[model samples]
Target chain A: MSLIDSISRPRAVRLPRIDGLIQWIVPLAIIAIWQLASVTGFVPTRVLPAPSDVVLSGWKLLLSGELVRNIWVSFWRASIGFLIGGSIGFAFGLANGLSQLSAKLTDTTLQMVRNVPHLALIPLVILWFGIDESAKLFLVALGVFFPIYLNTLHGIRTVDPQLIEMGRIYGMTDGELFRRVIFPGALPSIFVGIRFALGIMWLTLIVAETIAASSGLGYMAMQAREFMLIDVVVLSILIYALLGKLADSASRVLERLTLSWHPAFQKR
Target chain B: MQTALRTALPETELASQANFAPHARVVREERLAQTSGLPLTIRGLRKSFGDNEVLRGIDLHIPAGQFVAIVGKSGCGKSTLLRLIAGLDKIDAGSISFGQDVKPEDIRVMFQEPRLLPWARVLANVEVGLGRDRASQDADARAERALTEVGLADKRHQWPSVLSGGQKQRVALARALVSRPRVLALDEPLGALDALTRISMQRLLERVWRDQGFTAILVTHDVAEAVALADRVLVIEEGRIAHDVVVHAGRPRARGSVELAGLESSILSHLLSADDRT
Candidate 1:
């Protein structure tokens, strides 16, 4: 056996599949580099603490329940705002799309409104709603509204009119047409709106929280930055990234489940 | 616009077919007969987009149970004519009245594409042609029967995507037929099918037309298909009926027979001549 081992080399170590490896590799690589930098003083310990220190801080915050409290406050703000904004956007988009006069009157104004960034209205929002949660929620809601509206309008308008005629000739009532034909036809675009709206929700939330909040991951990061608690600041940013990823993945799962009939999502 | 083919066919045969089987004289005539005097009259149908006139002062009366096949080359207003009849588009200077009391629900159109809801099952799509009160268990049974007519009874739960192109078209036909509509309009229903599939579907359509006896108006680019299937093929050119040729070959038409081939060739030449003229 010893002679054979010497004569014939052992097989090379096998690597895991790309998808399987990515799960652990990315987080490990990040932690390892972070640890290495901290140890080497490439990035100063004071300015950018070690990965272990950030993890410790994160655990402490979690255990104290401060993180959960702040996270819930932030989530509720986003959720309520998203619902309000998303519904209005969907309704208006569909109405404008179906009616010629409504579309002609509203499209130009909507286009103009969309060009003006939601953040540009921060001062005005603060004046109207004050520095309370309502102002922050309103900002996030406003941020989410336009993309959902525009995408919904585009989706509704682009449905084949032949299909609509088919619906009509088949004795489908207006309600039946909307439910069976129009809604399903526009679903893929509606999902696009949801995705875009989700993104905007996060952006507005972060900006609003940073500017005025007493709590929230965004507020925590801002406070940590002022105190030069580099590890805590890093932890807050990481929390934000995780939350955003979780929300996006959840939306994608919902989309896939609902739009199973869509060409892209259909199983082989 | 009388053509050589029209002149070649015996005038007596034309007159005899026109008078003898007046109900079966055209594709939609048999269907119109089922309605027992359907007053589907149109006068001076005109449509235009900017300065381009797609339809120009066209007048045609689709009597009850008239199975009319409107044939035209691309941009010859064949589809426009069908759309006008189906009431999918409004005529600029024409009036279409389907009797004095005909409801919109009584008219059913089967388009070239199935236009089925991909998310909906075959049965549900078939039932889509019926209203809520009309969509009962009996209606569902009727839908199944319609599916059976199309030879797709077993595919009731299948999604539209899972079906073949021909199967999808069959489902569309079932949906159109399920309504028991007085007027059934077909806009090149089999235009997208492969050659073998198209032949089978033609047979299926003939079978269904015989059984259901609904008025069907088909708009097709295939002159041979028109001659083989339709009772009277109406050639539309420049928004008017240029020629109307009756196929005296009778039902259960033999596939690739000399008589059928001769008629097909004659119709093909007419279309080619029209193309050359343009």
Candidate 2:
């Protein structure tokens, strides 16, 4: 046999494959233990509901349309906030990246401002815009801006200078240099920024809704807590987790499509 | 061999003989007779980085379509000279003049690394050589033609990262030649390849230079490579031209031939003596 075959063939047999339904075994065991604890009165239901209780409450909310409506409201807020914040971040990042004068003028201030936590601005935002949609939108927008901006700037700065020099030597105009070399070279990092901003978008929405909003997943959970509906609260938390996972999966798909040329994305 | 040549010839005659071959003189004159490409004229060129002078005042003339190789030790400013000719860096003093046929856009430099855009496929990366005029009708056809010349037409759709080191350098060669540049400056373009690949690449480069008829200036530390491809091999020591040895061997020159090995040894001795003086 060839050396490569000799080296690789037995390695597959030594490591057991984790695939198919076997991957779900641990999650199922966790649910089974939780159910047993609830049924045996090892845990109080009022403080923490059983898996079945959470599912039943979720079904009830689904039938009532309250869960869907709240989810829609939360989704709308996150989308609008992200669109506004992400665009500004991208524009500022591009401007600073391309010109030293702009970077010198704006970078220090932006960095100083970025260090202030967006959540800490909750009281100030309420005072300025009141407990309205504007306040919530502003909070979410502020929260999502820094990651995208910082990452975009970092990406532009870290592009290989050799490539840029090659572009210039090949007779590329300034605009063409930016379009073909700078932008694509910075794209992978920009995508990282976008993914990080998406997570922050959800977190900021939760905080905004929990503090003052009338209709979102966070507000639904708070309302359930007031009524001592532990199962409904658990269901809301689960919905948030599901939404976060969906957003993350969508971003990964986009990354795969855009960065197919990257070696990291190539199939073995 | 040196003593035999010295004893058989006078000092002034030996100095002139070492500069270039009679056959190279014929080729240089024939190339100068053609009016298609530009000849390079450099005089009193100087460059410095902080306090260290990279290139002292240097002067050279290159006829159009002549393949010239510069051999130097590390940090001898051979690449600095190539960069100045390619207009990638400014000279501290003196002037470089190209013939009227040559425009700023007609010069291209191929770096040692392929420097291909990782996000682009092979064909698109070659297409980048067309610059901003990519929307022209014949740009795609020309890019394909250049790739085909480099023997990489079939790999047009592959990513650069998927290419081996030699293949990537071939792609880089295709990109450099895609624009049909009048002056092609190569900064140790094949330095990163293995021995076998380097030989193949040298052949490819010589073939391309012959086919394209551009003024080729290559910077390398390999003395054998300098003798193999270049019509004139310039040895740079202490940021100046120390020796100019012209290869008289004809095209499709034999590798490791007795004559070529003799020239290589002579150049090696000159380089070592120069190092000792420094």
Candidate 3:
């Protein structure tokens, strides 16, 4: 047989396909049990609002445009903070990775600073920026920067030296060497940084918004708790869950698109 | 023979003799005049790593379009010699001169590993050999032609991860040849292949070398492969040339013929004896 035919030929027996409904079975069953318990008074609705009540509250907020407006506000803050932090991190990574002088000058100081929890700086940030957007932006940016910077530096440091030698032998100038070999070799790690930073971005925003902000989903949830509006609080939590899942899914899609050439992603 | 005379002398004496060899210079110049491609000349090449001297005052001269193979035991510095010639490393002492027509960028080396960029398609990886000026429209066409030469034109669009070992090496060969280099250096390029695939690749390499007419220097430990592909085989021992044999057989020679086998056994014996001395 031909090589490609031998490799590409299917070996496993065909299995029946399920259209992913199997995944929803358990979550639906849990919702059904919860709804039954709430209606039959097995569990009091005051302590835990019914899923229907949470949905109704979400719909009310949506019609009033409060939910959308808060979401927009939170999204922009996260994006701005992420962009500023990610850019700085990427630049530092490239600098430290390519030059030993830069690494010697900055790497030790950065490592020492990164160990301190960024959230611990919240009080100081609030003191410095005074409850404005700057405080939340500073917190989120601090949280996201370390993962990106460290991973980018690691990725560049770990590229195969043999490949670099190959690039040099093939007549690539120093700039060409960086662009063709070093940058692409470092990209997979940078993507890892991006995904991790995105998670940290949301987490830091939530803390920052809750502590000081008057306008975001975290603030809404905090206000609902104060007023004993359990449905709206549950609704806010659900919104965060959905947004987190959406962001993670978006990262996965980006990974698939950029890393189609990678072997880890090629196995079906 | 000159090989016998050179091997009989100690390395220090040989290094001194090489400094005053007027006859050798005349021969080298005549060879250069007759050759169409780049000729390589190395004089008293020496390299050391910390305390372990890898190559000690080695000298070699290769005429253009000549396929020369260097065979030695592991750590005998054959690969190091090829690396030095390919300009991948600096020489501690010696002069290496190429023909006037040849630029430093006109030499390409292929390692045992294919070393294709995992993030690039086969064609794009081959086009990398064309250097940074890949914006020209002809870059793709030249890469496609090289792929066709290696019988991998159909596989150009596929990722390097999908290629088989032999196929990947062929892609590497395509990349090395895409620039139409005047000199090609192979550092055990087929060492990782299976026995059968290795034979086929040897044939393919021979065919490519014949058609391209580039000066080819191959560093291999396999004695049979050295005999099968090289016009002249130099056996390196303790960082110096111990035996130099010119194969009298012509191209398309039978693989299992007694003449080739005789040469292979003699080279193997020389290698084994060199091992015994160390």
Q: What value does DockQ give for candidate 3?
A: 0.55
Best-matching candidate per TM-score: 2
Misplaced by over 4 Å in model 3 are A1-22, B1-35
Among residues 3 or more apart in sequence or in different chains, the pairs in candidate 3 whose N, CA or C atoms overlap within 3 Å are none
Which whole-number lDDT from 0 to 100 does residue B208 have in model 1? Answer: 84
**In candidate 2, what are the lDDT values of residues B69-186, reduced to their tens digit?**
9999999999999999988888899988885746555888898999999989999999888765677899889999999999999999999999999999999999888888888999
Instruction: Tell me the tens digit of each residue's lDDT in model 3 across B119-200.
Output: 8899999998886556678999999999999999999999999999999999999999988888999999999999999999
Error of 2 at A93 (Å): 1.4
lDDT (tens digit, per residue) of candidate 2 on A1-268: 1223323544434435654466579988998999899989999998779999999989999999998899999998999999889988988899898889999999999999998999999999989998878888898888888888988998899899999988887778888889889998998889889989999999999988998878889999999889989999889988898899788879888877887887777644
Q: Comparing 2 and 3 by DockQ, which wins?
A: 2
TM-score of chain A of 3: 0.90
Against the reference, the lDDT scores of all candidates come to 0.78, 0.84, 0.84
Residue-level error in angstroms, candidate 1, position B1: 23
Per-residue C-alpha lDDT of model 3 across residues A1-268, encoded as one tens digit per residue: 1224324645464343643465578888998999899989998989998999989999999999999999999988999999999989999999999999999999999999999999999889888998888898888888889999999999899998988988887777899889889998998888889888989999999888888999999999999999999999888887887888788778777877877887766655
Off by over 4 Å in 2: A1-25, B1-36
